[model samples]
Target: MFFNRRTPQSAARPTGRLRLGTAAVAVLGLGVLTACGGGSGCSSEAPDSTTIKDLVVDVLAEPDSLDPFYRNTAEAQRYYRLVYSSLLQWNEDGTLAPDLAAELPEVSKDRLTWTVKLREGVTFHDGSALTAADVVHTIEQAKDPENGAVWLAAMSYVESATAQGDDTVVLKLSEPYAYLDGKLAMLPIISDEDDYKPNATYATTGNGSGPYALASLKRGDALTLERNEDYYGEPMKFETITFKVVPEDASRIARLTNGDSHIVPDLPTDQVELVTKRNANAVTVESNVSRLFAYPSMKADRPTSNTDFRLAIAYAVDRQRIVDQVYSGAGRPNSTYLTYGTLHHDEDLGLAFGAEPDLAKAKEHLAASGVELDRKFNIIAVNDPQVTSAATILQSNLKDLGIESTVESQDVAGFYANLVSGDYDLILFDAPASTSTGFAPDYVNGGLNSQAANNFAKFADAEMDDLLDVALTAQGEEAQAEAWRAVQQRDVETQGNIQLVVSQSSQAWSKQLVGYEPSALLWLNTLRDVT
Candidate 1:
């Protein structure tokens, strides 16, 4: 899924490049032979011949699509950061800065109109000049209903985008959104917006204006990228980056320890020290924007549709035990849907369940559910080590309540497909909200509404929908906070989903890498700054 389909080769060296099928390296254990050797793409050579200036990363899975308008997977979002440039960019400290825009947007006194000036001398990878027209086209396509854009909900407030001249674009908003700049930071500017539809050149391969460009890709195997020498911003320190597909956690950790790769993200908590003990470095970046959550299927035919049954499942599980055992105590147990860093979350909000299990309360809810003991609940999850471990713990917790259940693990693609189809009683996964504005208007308004496309749980409630609308459209901070609190209280009472804990973003890098920093807003985009 990393690239379009390509034929396999033993070891083909292009005119000036050596292609290493890294997906095969997992079985061969050839750690040292994967270096980019004396290639034209290698602008400068490393001091050691075994490793070059190129950054080799071991990733778990390939993204389903490279198009920004279609898929919003974590892997694809990181790829977009490398290949595309946005109107605004977030600084490491979570401040907004100009990227493609000449400066911060100029807002009207009423905060309804936004005026942006495009930067001059910037060019797309396809050699087209970037202008205000591209920006207008991007926003129009994103907000259009016929496009079926994944970001349609986030762009609802944007009424219209019009270009004044060659360099200026103006936006008219339906309401005054305080966080509109943060949303602009997430929108990537694309060239030739006329061809930005599905199955176009921008879908299979990226044509962007960022620091990197796709050189070659072998589907499900390896991806090779070359630095954009004509980039307008600060050039990438590394000349090229090679992403190797290594699905097994142990193999990925071993590759990092043996100096096969420079960076590996999402390391298992127990294996963090293994890389640190060696010459490598391991870091766990804490983030409250993302959380590990369990969402119950709210289909009317399913037993989990009952509020009492859902609450019983929520109260029966011991979140503290799961946090300690599965996560190595790196996170805090949470009972509410929103994390502490989410917009409008406060200490006085709803937390219907305790951190530890309450068996008596669980029994009371179970008796009130009227669910038969013979019905077996099917819990679905991805086939990761920690995810499977958490599923087992939840399985045991349900057994204690005289309930029968089974854990069904699938690969990432299958897991997401099943989740969207609503074929399971429960689904467990991590939700990474990669925006500086937190998870309020986008995830809350889109992921929980009954008729919304991303509402995977099929949860339907008119009051919940109204509360979400208030949370998104409210003008003042106090009004927004009050609406968010009401939404959480309703969420707790309904138990549409169970929030488990806020997990830390963990990764390990080789000591040879320098100037690396952890970022909650920009995950691997920071790699451009690392040498």
Candidate 2:
């Protein structure tokens, strides 16, 4: 699952200059390196002229696809970071950093148009030259549903995506969108030619203006990549690398421990004790991955349709207990939907949830709503171990309040279908991202829309709609900030479907893995220099 929080294009009347990607480097508070130096399509601390070595990585879920546009999940986006390029990228601190684009965009006085300059000598993985035409075609294709740009569907404000020159791209908007940079940050550009597959498969085949190429593919097992010798930036550290899919969390950790693999993600929380005791030489870096337990606003008639009911559930939930029992205190607590460390969080928004269980208070709300005890509900979640565990915990928590709950586990295909079909009651919805530090186009009206936030659930607020309208039409940091703050307060205080919690992101790596950042985005191309 890729992290959300990208801003939308529709709000800004984004004419499609360059919508930024998820500026997640500022996770909830963190932030991309995509402006120029196309070597691996990643954000780098420093540039090196020397050759880099090759390394393989292991992850929990096999990448869903290699098609950059359709790949919106964190894992897919991370992979694209290595293989694709974008106008602007996010730094680790959630700042609006540059990537494929040479410099920051020039927004017009009216905020309806934006101009971006391309980095010098950047080329697609196909060795095709980069130009204004490529950018426009790629972006327009993204808006086309048939093109499979999941990230693009969320951005609707772009009225025109055009090229100002061979190296400059201009976007004209119907409105003013602040998160355009964030939106572009999430979408790494690819060739618009028909040589590539618009409908890619999980078989994992991809090529772009990135640092690596698809060297090999083996469905349900592994993927091998070859470094792009002509990469636009510093050459990668690795000559050859493999992405081994180890679905079992324990096995992934075991491979790292046995030195069979260099890196692995989604390591089991339960096994932390054993790994620390056994792999003293290994380094475990904890990251804040954003996730929210969405009751999906589907129950328009049920007690959950009420904001009070949602808050009660949020209040009743002992997030600390989950941290203690399920996560072992490896993660941090979250308040706003944005990740930790980012700006704009209401630091003073005290937790409605208290220490200790409050099933009585929970039941009282249900009683007042007349929803009745023993009301059966379904909690849908992706098949991650932690998610499953969380669902079970919710089951028990709701049960304590006299509600009968069942846990439903499904793969991504089934999960999305169920979510969109409105078949389930509650789901583990990964909220679109927008943190204290920033937002990309994908998270806002420009990217994946809250229609899911609403359709699956139907949360409608006149105030929020008004804020979005004003924010979309306004310009300048002051105006946008004021509107955005109102939006954040509303979501944080009441309509918070995307919750806040530092995620238990695990990376089991042996000493052999040197440069790879163990990210949910699964960025490995950036680790090419690893010996």
Candidate 3:
């Protein structure tokens, strides 16, 4: 299933001038160069050079589609961030900043209308000037339910967008949403001439207004992007950048070690030591992504439907142990759904499952639940190795609590179907909050509020809904924090969902590549500044 995608952290507006760093000496590895550098888009001729004009990056998978509105996968979002320009960009600290927008949006007194002024002189790759009309068209397309836009949740409150003039656009919302500005950062502004159908792949040929333009795409092999010379913002350093799909972790690391690829992202935790040993000079960065286990509350007949049973399950598992064993010490135990560094994360709320498992507490909660001793429930998970490992760990933990659970793994499509249908008692999945804004109202609403579209767990609490409403419309930071803290407390008390651990995502790049820094958002668009 397609999870929410992250964007780059906002930093000082990039000057776009290439800033090269010191190059690290290449170390030869023992393995003969395999599929990565042999015939898979990487050049084998230069095995130790660092001064290459063109850059080849190893991505885990090819994007499902180039159409921003059609796909929400990380791969698709990464490509979209590079090829398309949004009205606003996120600061490194998760604050909103203007990109295509000339300045901050002006909101009406009632908070229903937002007037946005577009930056002048910005042109798409096709050389058409970007105007309020383009923004209006993009919003209208996403707001249409028939389009099945992945980010439709963020704009559900948007009533309509109208262009007042060549450079100003006005948006009317059904209700006041405090996160509206932050949500708009994810809605990329596209060319008005571009037409994309729902679930259909759009062959992008340099049609965006971002730093890079699509040069060519060889599906399942490589995607070539050339620097957009007419880009209005900071100019890209590399004239050409090619993303090579290297599905295997070993192959991607090999490409980086052999100097065939400049960067490789989403490195497997198990392969971290191997990458470091092979290429000691490679630069590695890590950032945490939120992960959780959700119980299907709508399944009233299931044991997980009972709050006491859910709490019992929570107390049975050791989150820190899972972080160390399953994630190979590349994860942090999270108390709430939000990452630790996110805004409004309350340390006082403490760990929900505690530092370790409390078997006695688990037993007490289980006894109170009054579930049949012989009852058997299934824990469903996506067929990813890490997710499966986590599921197995939880399964073993529940067994110790005298509970029987069978772990079932399915592919992404099947897994999402089961979640939506509430066909399983428990589901181990990743539900990350928006990293760009570092906020949780949207996330809480999406996962816990009764009216949320993605509430696969079928969890509904009046207190949670009320707190979310207050948090979303609160005018000041203190008010918002208070509301969010209460919401977190209520989630813990009711056992809305058990947050297992926050996983650290790793990205490896050649030391020669500079001007790139890791952000919690994990957006690859920052590659535009790397030399």
Best by TM-score: 1
Output the TM-score of candidate 3: 0.80
RMSD list, candidates in order: 11.4, 7.6, 8.3
**Tens-digit per-residue lDDT, 380-433, candidate 1:** 877666777888898999999888889987776677655666667888877664
Q: Per-residue alpha-carbon lDDT of model 2 for 329-445, expressed as tens digits?
A: 544444444334233233334233443457776666556555543457777877777777767777777777666788888777676665555566677744313321234322433
Off by over 4 Å in 3: 1-50, 70-73, 93-95, 108-112, 123-129, 144-148, 173-176, 191-196, 201-207, 213-226, 269-274, 280-287, 295-303, 367-376, 431-441
Model 2, global lDDT: 0.56
- Please identify model 1 stretches exceeding 4 Å from their true place: 1-52, 145-148, 198-203, 348-351, 433-442
Q: What is candidate 2's CA lDDT for residue 144?
A: 69
How much does candidate 1 score in TM-score? 0.84
Q: Give one digit per residue, the lDDT tens place, for model 3 in 178-203.
A: 67877777777788876756655354
Rank ordering of all candidates by TM-score, starting from the highest: 1, 3, 2
Candidate 1 — worst ten consecutive residues by lDDT sum? 12-21
Query: Residue 470 lDDT in model 2?
Result: 67
TM-score of each model, in listed order: 0.84, 0.78, 0.80
Q: Judged by lDDT against the true structure, how good is candidate 3?
A: 0.66
> What is model 1's C-alpha RMSD?
11.4
